[model samples]
Target chain A: MSPPLADLSAPPAIRPSLAARLAARSGALTGSTAGLALGHAQANLAVLPAVYAADFLRFCQANPKPCPLLGVSEVGAWTIPSLGDDLDLRSDIPGYRIWRDGELVAEVDDASAFWRDDLVAFAIGCSYSFEEGLIAEDIPIRHIEEDVRVPMYRTSIDCTPAGVFSGRMVVSMRPLRPPHAIRAVQISSRYPAVHGAPVHLGLPHLIGIADLARPDYGDPVTVKDDEIPVFWACGVTPQSVIASARPSFAITHKPGTMLVTDRRNSDYAVI
Target chain B: MSPPLADLSAPPAIRPSLAARLAARSGALTGSTAGLALGHAQANLAVLPAVYAADFLRFCQANPKPCPLLGVSEVGAWTIPSLGDDLDLRSDIPGYRIWRDGELVAEVDDASAFWRDDLVAFAIGCSYSFEEGLIAEDIPIRHIEEDVRVPMYRTSIDCTPAGVFSGRMVVSMRPLRPPHAIRAVQISSRYPAVHGAPVHLGLPHLIGIADLARPDYGDPVTVKDDEIPVFWACGVTPQSVIASARPSFAITHKPGTMLVTDRRNSDYAVI
Candidate 1:
């Protein structure tokens, strides 16, 4: 049987800058940014009122693998000039999930209407950057190969708590043969800002995942008989923590939709 | 109780250069170079007849975690200038263990007496470099604190085979609390030329180590109630493989007594 189509379309002639992309989004560009902006960094977004920002920053620092901080906007400011020339936190991301008292109130294209002067925006390093590295190395990503979302699970491993933010680590899984898995470890080790290497491999149940077919988050992909499941700490972790913490107000990028930044993925590579 | 004395001592005024140190050996150094040449790299030595050198090189390449190659000498050549000026493989190391058909035949200060025109020397990176890094980070090493050798064990994990060299990996263990273990992973990861990050952690039995108190090599240090055993692939693995390969002739540095080179440990740090 033919393999499923990957979102691997050729780059458009007018490669947009971070500002151009954000400007183009009349509302928010609510589509998956998987293969867009090939060489640039994409970020997971989290906006919280200034009151919870300090605790959230501490949370990211303590749980780096899951919530590697890329950039942080000042309270009452939507611009992170270091991340982009004129990035606007309210409308740059393709979509935003607005939460009130830990309950999802709405999924909106633009968060400008809901933005408060006391809000602080956190831009986090995303796994999509490392996936590019993996593809460049010719290691097959099962989900991309099958055209499905990478499988994610809520693991028994608990994140180090910081103030009111604490929850089980949510991990994304990919199945690969042992050799590829080893190579993946070496490649991923170069990008610590993007989750680094696998937290666990080979056994899923050991991390409390009962079934490979039933992931707690994204859709499951095929796991061949000869392959082992490799799990990486996912950026979804902060969202999970925010949910549990039941913050009075919180804003996050919708699943799979991220903020494209001017910074290149290579900027995050350590070696 | 006062902490046990570290091997730290003032460097002798002579402050011998790599060449001077080798010249002064008279025979081989025959003593642990642990606290000497504070910043220089120390290497584990392995010399084999030219007939088996190619296969051994391949083996090191395939299983880098256990045998990270720092330098390899040309057949019959005594020097690896990249590692140190005028390095004489046969006499630069403090001591050598001569093996004939897999059995250790003798321990000599120098292997110059057994040096053949067909012999090739390999210098493998040692853990001592990363130990310097760990110490610099203020991470307490239990064995170092207790003035005992680090414990080591043979694990069930097999090394990737190349030619006739194949065996279970030998690992050195350090017991540390969870927080320190996490920090160690981040620190050691910067020095891939050494063993790099740990191969296994937490549960010892999971890696086939039946008893933490009974080490296969080196003296077992205390494992505290809150600590977990962290294991790194050891340079001893190649020596173990040499024993099993039963090469017609082999020469290796005596355990703990390595060849000091001009390269600094910091030179191997990736970031």
Candidate 2:
């Protein structure tokens, strides 16, 4: 489980570097890194065999809103120096999900056991970057306020196809009053690498979301009468696409267990 | 009247400089400058007495979305050289609406007779700059396509008050399909000086706009069943505020007529 709001708000007395955090995670820090290295960029991870890397890259390029590609490692390389110095792709993340034929076969602390010379690591931008922006602007994030996960919905919108990777676009929802929603658009638009502005707002059914209370993934929080549900393109989209593609072997960071990088979230802001 | 779409699309064999256009207007060219000087920035003009200038500047600073101030000339000066070299404020624009105590007293071709030593000229960012951007991006602007004025509405949302200048925010509406609307947000966001992104979208009544067909100003264009109305903070807002404030004397560019500046529209794009 993620830490409470009070705990998340207070950083550790000693702020460790990204290299130090990854080394600690490799040793014993095996859990979600939700609020760790708060100002730095945290990335969603996907590792696949060299054969599927090209197709996946094209998929991300075509559907940038959902799969904002931050960095892609060279084939068989464990280090993506652009994202973090001295980082090991196989062991840097705190937790990993190992998949075979798109089925989750095991959850592990590190991926060294399944590491292969034919693997490629893909780093994707996450909404955590923009959520920090929203919070900085004092925009109320209901899920964080209520201590629940942001609701995720599988929308009617389709991701543009690229080879074997194709599926419906998935979105995360946050309920905000009209004024806050407008401000959210402005704030979020600055961070285009992290899903950018909203993909949809107000009318959910137009995007085929049947109920605000029943999300396809994550937990639903309160949507007050004064607030309208705002939706953003989600990182989970690539995970969903990977499942539908049914690759022979695949790996992803366990949800919320992101790769904490040396890059600050502000680095991704376009303006 | 503005020229037809075909004429507007075809640039004159020899494009005129800002000074040349002003000289033409000062002579016999007295009509809307819509679609003229295709690539250059065009601004809405507001001239007020020195007594009201300070409050008006504060009003613009407080309500930037609607009244994005581009350049404010020195008190009683006719030249805002930053906007255009040798540009005379009194006779540059093709048409002017002279107001006395908030009532439209005259529609003149030149403001030289009305110009006073106590008057201050304000050049405000206009939507025409961003409209060119949208058109370049292949997003069809309904008003421009139908060759009519863009619809404007007085919203329930109030402007942040500054001194004696206070009124409801006025917005300009455009109907775009969902995909085009999403792209519009991205394109418009790059030009913050010209209203930036939309203020409200989709549900019009949520902002107290009861009827889309009967706009408070400008001609209404078609809002198709597949389209959602996107609203942006409009330059007309200051005019509306001036009407309500009822200053002793004021001057504004007549509707659809703007002051063509030497600055390229591209210069205003942040990205």
**Candidate 1 global lDDT:** 0.85
- Scored by TM-score, the top model is 2
lDDT of 2 by residue, A181-249 (tens): 777887888888989988987778888899999998889899987677889999989889888999999
Clashing pairs in 2: none
lDDT of 1 at B171: 96
Least well predicted 10-residue stretch by lDDT in candidate 2 chain B? B14-23
RMSD of each candidate? 8.2, 7.3
lDDT for each residue of candidate 1 in B1-271, tens digit (9 for 90 to 100): 9988865685555435574456536754467777678888888989999999889999999999999999999999987889977667778888889999999999988788999999999999999999998899899999899988889898998999999899999999988765466567778888899999888775567678899999988898999875667789999998899999999999999888888888999999988
- Per lDDT, the best of the predicted structures is 2
Model 1 clash number: 3
Q: In candidate 1, residue A213 scores what lDDT?
A: 98
**Per-residue alpha-carbon lDDT of model 1 for A1-271, expressed as tens digits?**
9988866686655545564456436654567777778888889999999999999999999999999999999889988988887678788877889999889999988889999999999999989999999999899999899888888999999999999999999999988765466567777878899898778776577678999999988898999865767889999999999999999999999888888888899999988
